[model samples]
Target: MSSVDVTTVGRGPGLVVLPGATRRARHYGAMATALSEMYTVHVVERRGRGRSPAQDSSYCLDAEISDALEVLTETGSKQIFGHSYGGLIALHVALRTDLDRVIAYEPGVSIGNTMPRSWMPRYEQLLAEGKDARAMVHFLHTCEFMPGGALVTAMVWAMQRFAAEGRATRELLPTVVRELHEIYALDSDGSRYGAITAPVLLLGGGRSPAYIKQMLPLLVDVIPNAKLVVTPEFDHNAPDLGHPAAVADLIRA
Candidate 1:
């Protein structure tokens, strides 16, 4: 297997953070910094992003879990925090291994076809047409959070600026598409998660879509040691977005 890139920040007990579909560990700078104050933060740059090698044909959810396991073993971090698709990966890891604690923020587990089956094809078409920005916009719109008009408009503007500035959000499109496919392909039942023995803190956002919010209860009911917490003031990207401090406080608590 290819080597995974792990970046360390702060000082204290080991804490590994797995970012969402964005797969950009650097984007979690604020949250890592905050958590670093209380724990040594090890951020894993998922394959196809940052310093991690690009994904090959063999890439799959198992590969992601393996990458995470390697990081956990290398860092000896028993505590993990995962957001979005990363959360699903973390949960899977906990199910198969013994982890002290897990804190997941809106894992992209589908329950009752939470994701529209038509989205993948539409997103692929946009990518084929070289409309990466539009593809991202559409992807966000379809997300469980269903970002509103203002947020969507702002994201479009930001994406446009990034493209103009040569930062090109388009570069990350393939990884985004692949991860979305992975999420959609997953079966929604929490029955398998019942085997996880680690204590879990399932978090969601009040402003997030009903589907996203609904996962917390199902997860809590299935995972014997799980609890749910909703941060009413934030949405899906709480840690990397506006409420890193709030999220950090929760982690610390």
Candidate 2:
């Protein structure tokens, strides 16, 4: 918690954002730009990304959540928005900390009985072997689901294309692969949400994976003071595609 560097925008109460493991704070530039105009936005760079500290070994969700809390304390912002794995961290923060409010955008921690039981260990092995492309492809085909099969296929294709150039993809790939263990370690049985007293906005994309849809209602049941926001026009990655103004307005409300 000592001297964690933060990239701030605007000037007001803190509104810290935690990006997905594969994305850096810079990737949320569009959202930060808009949110900054209204409230001071602190985009957490996450450990090991950019100038942040280097992650020398394995990672855990608790550690990631602690990093987010560090940002919150550093910026003094109780309002937080977490996307994907970031959302999972936000949820943990709400459960474990005194964050004024939180917005979790489509966290994929729930696999239920639908997921292939073998995928986790296999992914771990691939990651250990340094076969990231193969690992990512495996994750997409099995665990990278986002509701509709067609859309998942398209998104996976795009990600694969981007990942084809190893150098271009190296920056985030290690984090993504290394953090898989942490993400899977999350317990989404709804027990953790009972501790959250803040007004939580659970945002989901209609076109997201069926598992995501299945998990949404569960979140409502667990988070004491929470509401649902389903956006049919956007998918899991929509927040990065200019949805922050709308999101900021929701937070402001």
Candidate 3:
């Protein structure tokens, strides 16, 4: 909570963004640039990537919340947007703090063991053995991408070795494991989210994983002052990777 890495942009009311697991501050460069004209966007480089301190022995979701609170307090910002796992953190932060608005972009909220944990054992063992690329296979398998058979696995392995995503995903395999654990540990039936006081916007990608799509509707129903918005032209990684400009448009709307 002391000195976290944050990439700041723009000149208006501050809006903090938390990237999903394995994503770095620079991964959101395009999004930050798109939103800069309207809002001072502070894209946090969450722990373990970039210049931020690595996740230690006791890292957990609570630790993530503490770091986010520091960003909000330091910037005097009350608005937040979290992508994927970051969305989950942003929502939980609102549960414990006051905020003017909260936007969760396809949050990885696990409803009653919906976020699969079966891949953990093999993934962890491969990571411990220094087989990071191999470990990525197990995690990607859990993603349940339709028709993601041998070709997808082959691409995952090749990406680890050749693609620039090697660092963004393959190299950060260790952190992804930890983040997934946090998701699984918080599994519930969406009841507890009723405590969030801020008016919420549950942003989702129409083309994202089916489980992700399923989770958002239940979230809208539980949060007292929340609404659901889906962008059909987008997917799970749109905010940082593909549709930042359009996503920014939604944030200001």
Q: Which candidate is the best by TM-score?
A: 3
Better model by lDDT: candidate 2 vs candidate 3:
3
Ranking by TM-score: 3, 1, 2
lDDT of 3: 0.86
Candidate 3 all-Cα RMSD? 1.8
C-alpha lDDT of all candidate models, in order = 0.81, 0.71, 0.86
* Tens-digit lDDT track of model 2 for 39-70: 89888887777677766775567677778777
The Cα error of candidate 1 at residue 79, in Å, is: 0.7
Q: Taking the tens digit of each residue's C-alpha lDDT, what string does model 3 give over 1-253?
A: 4468998989899999999987888888988898899889999988898788789888999988999999999998899999999999999999989999999999989886667678789888988997776677667667753334567667777877888777567657788878998899899998999999999999998888888888888889999999999989888889888888888888889
Instruction: Quote each prediction's TM-score.
Output: 0.91, 0.81, 0.93
Model 2: ten consecutive residues of lowest lDDT: 108-117
Cα lDDT of model 2 overall? 0.71
- Residue 139, model 2: Cα distance from true site in angstroms: 2.1
lDDT of 1: 0.81
Give the clashing residue pairs of candidate 1, or none: none
| TM-score of candidate 2 to 2 decimals | 0.81
lDDT of 1 by residue, 78-103 (tens): 99999988899999999878998999
Q: How well does candidate 2 score on lDDT at residue 32?
A: 82
Clashes of each: 0, 5, 0
Candidate 3, which segments miss by more than 4 Å at Cα?
145-151
